[model samples]
Target: MFTRIRMVVLATNAEGSPDLFLTTVDATGTQYEHGRHYDMALPRARDEGYETPMIAFDQYDAAARMLRRAATFIEGGDAATGN
Candidate 1:
């Protein structure tokens, strides 16, 4: 059977909130996905999910940023490993 599941948060972005990524998955082997390796960053990355003064990182590494944000950022899930 196919499943309609919510998008899982991959990681906190350079911005202070969850990086906005969504997907529709065909869990069963009957259907095939159309896209591969799709990535989007706006004309400029923008703050999301919260308007308050949340802390953001300036680092290039996502995992390193997450580690630095340990006290400040709320992790989405384990997918932040960039796996």
Candidate 2:
């Protein structure tokens, strides 16, 4: 029993150099590094139901950025922090 998974990495380039590396794990337990993209197959359960095999790098980046911004707001003189 095996499953297919995809990993998408997003990073910023500085002076032709790569900066910041983030890794994400899909349902198949495959790890992907930032600025690098790859796919692999994972072990799956025989009794598992239908599963969609896909990964959206843009979406993940957007969500991560949003969360970071939110955290900054909360930590930086924001009412939510109750500071």
Candidate 3:
């Protein structure tokens, strides 16, 4: 399954698209911005692949959604773990 490493929701554009930045699960702390002219960060799983990439929604729910989804990929050793 695809796992996210570092993902950040920057801002929601005037056109209503949410601005997102993220890096592959194999890598961490390195964030990439996602926009129309750029390719979104690819999701990756150690020793696995083919999982659907993360989807971005409106700004109203982006933060909550990201946090929930991101929690799934976090491991005990992950630096961002709020322990």
Q: Number of clashing pairs, model 3?
A: 0
Per-residue lDDT tens digits for candidate 2, residues 19-71, read: 33333334322333433223321112111221233233423456555545666
The models' CA-based lDDT, in order, is 0.34, 0.37, 0.38
Ranking of all predicted structures according to TM-score, beginning with the best and ending with the worst: 2, 1, 3
Candidate 3 residue-wise lDDT, 1-83, digit = tens: 33344433344334455544433332222332333211343322211232333353322345655565566547544435444
TM match of model 3 to true structure? 0.21
lDDT per residue (tens digit) for residues 13-44 in model 1: 55555543333333332321422111122112
Highest lDDT scorer: 3
Pairwise lDDT winner, candidates 1 and 2 = 2
Candidate 3 pairs with clashing backbones:
none
What candidate 3 gets wrong by more than 4 Å, as runs, is 1-5, 8-38, 43-50, 56-61, 64-83
Error of 1 at 74 (Å): 14
Name the runs in model 1 displaced over 4 angstroms. 29-83
Candidate 1 residue pairs in backbone clash: none
Query: Which of the predicted structures, 2 or 3, would earn the higher TM-score when compared with the native?
Result: 2
Model 3, global lDDT:
0.38
